[model samples]
Target: MSSLIEGYNYDIFISYCQKDNKHDGWVTEFVDNLKGELESTFKEEISVYFDINPHDGLLETHDVDESLKEKLKCLVFIPIISRTYCDQRSFAWEHEFIAFVEQASKDQFGLKVKLPNGNVAGRVLPVRIYDLDDNDVRLYESVLDTVLRGIEFIYREPGVNRPLKPDDDEKINLNRTKYRNQINKTANAVRDVITALEHYDHEPVTVAKDIFKPASIPSETGKTKIVTGSLILLALIVLGFFLLPKLLKSEGEPEKTIAVLLFQNYSGDPSQEYMCNGLTNEIIGHLYKIKSFDRVVPIDYVLPYRGTDKKPSRIADELKVNYILSGNFNTTRDTVRITAHLIDPRKDKILWQNGFDQPYKRIITIPADIATQIADCLKTNLTALEKQNIERIPTTNLEAYQLIQQTKNQFNTRTYESLNQLYDLSLKAIDLDPGYADAYAGAGSMLILTGTTFQHTAMQTVIEDALKLWRKALELDQNNASAHCGLALYNDWIIWDYIRAEEEFLKAIELSPNNQSFMKGYSEFLQKRNRLEDARAYKVKAEDDPIRIDILSLVLSGEKDEAHKYLNTYLQSKKIFAGEYFIWLEDYEAAKSICEAALQKKSQSMLAPRYQACLALAYYKTNDHHKAQMIIDQLIEKSDISLAGSPEFYTGWYYSGIGKIDSAFYWLEKAYKNRCPEIPWLKVDPGFKNIRSDDRYWDLYERAGHKAYDDYRAGLKRRKSNR
Candidate 1:
């Protein structure tokens, strides 16, 4: 179609049965339509070499091997798979299909080998244009199946900008469903093959089977033995039926789970909202530590019920918990009043109820007192250590408590203005009481986030300041879980100090064994280290706070679909801190959208600007560079944040997208200097995959401290040698 094709390479190769084309008169039309679609989609002239082309002399003289090889090198392959394609005389169809399959298999395996063996390979992708029945499909089953298994389908229809017809829609949907099922099967097959391929390099562990059976006895004793076995089986079944329930009853019923809903603001002054929320959260936190007692879900998980017309009983039932803790908090300028009641959802009875009035400042200790009283009433043993943990409030400074509450609230809003306000307030809290460990920890975390999100001019300076604050908090209170977690975040992301991060994370876990947030952060660190299995184990061990546990588990398991579902559901139902949670999962689009929505509600939120920047990167991921640039421009215009702090990290991503390798390398170097947390992930990151073979890329990877990359390469070499 273009003179450029003759000058350069093959554009398209049409492989079809000459008999089918000659008799049905449909093949030519199909070829022409496919060429048009390719041209339209790619916005370039595509030269299609059909076997049935009118240039008879050229076809006869065409170097079939060279032509197919050249076709394989092109962007796409169109294999016309009609019933007649199975004919042996169909050399075009046979040759093309075989070439496609061989290329695909070679690509999948050869590339892996070449990485270690210094060999080169080709890739093949397939396009199926005609329908064939089961028996007919069997003819080219190996080739078609291999191609289907190896490559993702790029769908194209005959019409221009036309929606599928009703029948066509049904057909396409059916095909898609079928394809998905086959692909899953193929994935499993590929996994098995890869596992086998690695066998020479490593020992294979035996997998436990679901069905357990005793080893069979010698077959000398047959009919009588079989009869005896049947009788014993019947007797065992009868025994099991009678004993299973009794055994379960003797073991006792499963522990009932309970959640405490946020206390209602009956004080009439909305300004006291923070006090009520803080009290509720503290109570939930206290109850959460009692692992031996009825489990208490976090108040954050239950906040979706507040202000809604739904009855407390209905809410409790929806959460599928046995009990509900509902309360109302009334506070004046000097004193606070609390009325709390625990209800049994199953029995629909109030199990416990209490009221307390204390000095407003002492409200911080109310949760421990209430929990102790409740545990006593329930006849549950509260170990001395557990009791101490519940009662432990790190700071008595009312100003610090108020600041922490406000900072947490603003952070949850996830807007740029809110984050700035939170930063200012947290700093003020620290200034008010320098010994406030929680304030310092919160400030450090916020500053680190600010450095990344807003492209702060003094990002490194801010992060360093954050690090100091966190270290100070830890020094003041060695067992402070939040402070330890903050230090871990700094070490892992900002300093590229993996060893320190790991130590801090492990220390945090040791100090606050049941703190789900700390466990999640630790799990994320393990993932970054390429210890996938260890990451999963830690995530599983994290406290089963639904939001935290589910999100962390999804991320560790690489279940992006489930993770997105859970996050969207949580965001729709409740207001909680999840911005960083989304970013950790690399769901930047969702994070940005959530932040933008929050901005609409709280216009001054500082977190919104950072989230907008995150969104720009997501756009970059999708190759919508214009949209990404626009968002970045908007952030620059609205905020005084400078890219210099984490310029390399951010610019590395932007330049990589535009194929500006040198620029990417420059920025990536800067990111490393700034200690951007994402540096370690660059090795396996598909964004840098294009430049991976470059010597500079390998140098960067080595500098990033991902020893696993070296291990992977070594593993590949071992595989090749074994082969």
Candidate 2:
């Protein structure tokens, strides 16, 4: 029998303070409302398990470990941070919060096996239900600084009347608005942090140094010493001219290469861990605008060496780059000091270095100054408008600046919890200054991530809210690329308005040419329109990250060998699993094998679901219909209906393999109508060779809108004749 609860799969795990629950039943009420909202939002009636439930049989039977283990196996820990919640004695707080952090870190960084038993743990969602002072949070300062740095903390107004009370609709509405805004901000923050963590773990170092070296001191006879010094200098110059170009050649082009290293944190408070990342992102954003530069990779590409014993020269050699830029920020209460250096990687010497200090508000101009300084050193000309654009600050508010940094951190993490955190933070920034367009844009992105992950019940509402926020953002700032991209994605996925999506995507690309997301999204749009050549071209122009390049190459070539080669290089460089890379090669069997191996090493990965789907497809392809059906059925039952598409596509393949022509046609028709790119392979696929002679097969092929198939053959003959 097909079962939904074959094993303990958790929807939510509630972490709350027993003390807070003691007074006025606040925790209980919050839990009830949250459960209702999640269930209503996802359309799945999920069981909400709490650590503090008094009548729990597991507690009485001394099976807390076993029960909690099972609970953790299927759990998404929701930490409710309040004043009392942060209290160390709160066992509910300690057990849940610690366990959640450990699990989440393991899931994210693959750190599960570090424990004694070497079992992987699940992820956690830290939800702040009430306000807590900095001091209260400080008690668990280390934990907060590490796991909860980018988490969304939902806060309710203190002394607000209870919702259960009569005639409290006004307060309830106010509180609901507050909670909604908080929830939205947290959601956004969670998404940002998760995305950052997933993508930006490596920091790229841009080589910076003083180009003009100090002249060597002369001996007593200065005139006589000039001969030796001049000869030495001349020889050095000659050696550089002959050898530098040959040594610094990149893979394709030999343009100036730059790497933005991790920014130094000036903030003395260790809790403010995101400041360095924020600074790094800002510099990267500015540099990304210079189109004349052939390649500018982010420090994130080299994150594996963070805190390692490797030198900058070693890293540069591995990346095969020419330059590295390093910087430090020192900030006081009212002033900020910044120092930066550019180095030549080949020479292992500093080419340029500079320092600047200014009032906190004036730090925005640092980008232009740094850019101009580096440009002068490199002998690259920058237009006046580019200089002005570099200096421009989107917002003057310090809070907004801080919020942007926090949002960026959260965005990079790319987990559900991180998305929620980003949303909450962005919402708070918006509330602080409703005129802040970027905050709204960030919130919209959070909504999109959330909808993409959960994809049911409240998805429409979430997406609509995202659109409204993006529109509001654009209304405030017409040229906001982030807002434009957010709207484009919203239109493309939720609304299915491809034309509008295309327009917005183009506008975003025009505004921010080097933005990786915009490039990838635009490429996908081109592919959707059957513009494969255009898609391939754009994919080449997009950022050359391992995952992105691998997927793009697979889409363009459909050659497993090429895909595998690229994926192997990527794996060697990154020293990590590339799950999506395996999927792109259509080597589902290999992908499934790797994922299973990873799971055995660290079982609690969210990647399991995605890989499970891949395995099902592989089984279907190999004609193991029963196994494929079993896996697909389980996935459909456990996951959202959107997951049903893949299984359905495979079902058609299975039917076709067994000579069920009518059923095969039914499935293939559905797949083709959905514009499944994989559907085209059916025309040339050996699995369906049996049906090639059928007249109905030709009709189905025509229905798939591949007129180019005939055109390509004719063009081939014409080209041969001409040759």
Candidates' lDDT values, in order? 0.57, 0.57
The digit string of per-residue lDDT tens for model 2 on 485-536 reads 8867765554444444555786676566566677777776655554445555
For each candidate in turn, the TM-score is 0.50, 0.51
TM-score computed on alpha carbons, candidate 2: 0.51
What are the per-model C-alpha RMSD values against the true structure? 27.4, 28.4
Candidate 1, 197-221: lDDT as tens digits: 3332322222212121221111113
- Where is model 2 more than 4 Å wrong at Cα? 1-254, 302-311, 348-352, 376-388, 413-417, 453-461, 495-500, 527-613, 620-623, 636-723
Model 1, stretches more than 4 Å misplaced? Answer: 1-252, 288-296, 331-334, 373-385, 409-417, 452-459, 533-641, 644-647, 654-663, 708-723
Top-TM-score structure, candidate number: 2
